[model samples]
Target: MTAVVNVFLKEGVLDPQGKAAHHALDSLGFAGVSDVRIGKQIIINLETEDRATAEAEVKEMCETLLANTVIEDYTIEIN
Candidate 1:
């Protein structure tokens, strides 16, 4: 099983890195680039016979280590 996790900061949080990228884009003459936000993605491969088990484990991983629940949100997809 393959699990893909996308972790990102919640809305209303200040993203300094995103702001820097936005400024850089504007300096390079890219107009109308209003905002930018940065996030992280993690892909995990596991040998599992049950899809539900894999999903539950991945969710636990996200909650425990992959994502910061206090300031971030995550979504997981299994393939």
Candidate 2:
């Protein structure tokens, strides 16, 4: 099994890195963008064959340490 996780700041939260990137884009004349959000992806390989178990384990990982539950939202995709 493989688990793909995407973690990003929740709406209404400040994303300084994203803001800086957006500003730099504007400075470079990429004028179509109005907002920016930054996120991270984590890919994990599992020995388990069951999709449900892989998903549950990844969810636990995210809730426990991979993400800040208070400020970030994470999605897990099992393949």
Of the candidates shown, which would achieve the greatest TM-score relative to the real structure?
A: 2
User: CA RMSD for every model?
Assistant: 0.8, 0.6
What's the TM-score of every candidate structure? 0.94, 0.96
lDDT of 2 by residue, 18-37 (tens): 99999999999999999989
Model 2 per-residue lDDT at 23: 99
- Over all chains combined, what TM-score does candidate 1 have? 0.94
Model 1 Cα displacement at 76 (Å)?
0.5
Cα error, residue 43 of model 1, in Å, equals: 0.7
Instruction: Give me the displacement of residue 78 in model 1, in angstroms.
Output: 0.6
Per-residue lDDT tens digits for candidate 1, residues 5-48, read 99999999898889999999999999998789999989999899
Model 2: ten consecutive residues of lowest lDDT: 50-59
Local distance difference test, candidate 1: 0.94
What is the lDDT of every predicted structure here?
A: 0.94, 0.94
Worst 10 residues of 1 by lDDT: 41-50
